[model samples]
Structure formats: structure tokens, C-alpha cells
Target: MSSMKYKSSEEFHDHLLGAIEKKRGYHLKRFEEHKSEQDKGAVDALAWAYTLIKFGKGNIKK
Candidate 1:
């Protein structure tokens, strides 16, 4: 029996696009909210800090 399981590369690409659509709105909202170098840099730094704190394997506790 045949199924809609993305049997080909093109089919897989098209199938997952709708999932990304939901994030598109959030992406644009974030882009509009931060239109300054300092604002963008701060946001980026917060992300980096969060990654270090959460996934740093407790190495950056100092």
C-alpha cells in the first residue's frame, strides 16, 4: 500500500513548509520589535547567555 510519508525529497520539502509557516509570524514580529543595533545585540547576548547557562554543562557557573 502507498502512503503520504514524503517518499521523495521534493515531497518532504513541501510537507514541512507548513510547519515553518507558524514561526514566520513570530519571526516578523521579532524583526519589527528590534530595529536597533544595541537592541539586537542585547537580544543576541541574552540568547547566548541563556545557552551558556542552560547547556554549558555547569562549566560557566563561575
Candidate 2:
């Protein structure tokens, strides 16, 4: 939901780092789930959704 747009890898990387920092169960689990995705688009979409959940619609950029 972030207004800030990110490249796919950027989204994934940010979420992964955020997960590490926050240590939220779902965030960490989601990061791992997305990490194993072989399709780039699926991974990107997963990252985008996770970023939205972690950062909200306008609070941060990926």
C-alpha cells in the first residue's frame, strides 16, 4: 500500500531487513516464504505486500 514504488529486489531486500529488525513472527515467516519463490513476479508481489504490511501506505519508502 506504500505510495513509494520499489523495484522487485528492493522491495524484497527492505522487507527482509525489516523482518530481521522487527522480529515479528509473520514478517519473518513471510520473508522466508518469499525468499524461496522461484518466479520473479511472484517474489516481487510478495515483497510488495509484505512491505505494505510492515511500512503502511505512506510512512516509508522501500
Shift in Å, residue 55, candidate 1: 0.9
Model 2 lDDT tens row, 1-62: 76655577557567566764454444446657676444444546556666665665345544
Error of 2 at 37 (Å): 10
Candidate 1 versus truth, CA RMSD in Å, comes to 12.3
The TM-score of candidate 2 is 0.29
Residues 1-62, candidate 1: write the lDDT tens digits. Answer: 87566556555544444444444445445757876665455556655544454454424221
Which candidate ranks first by TM-score, i.e. highest?
Answer: 1
Best by lDDT: 2
**Candidates' lDDT values, in order?**
0.50, 0.56
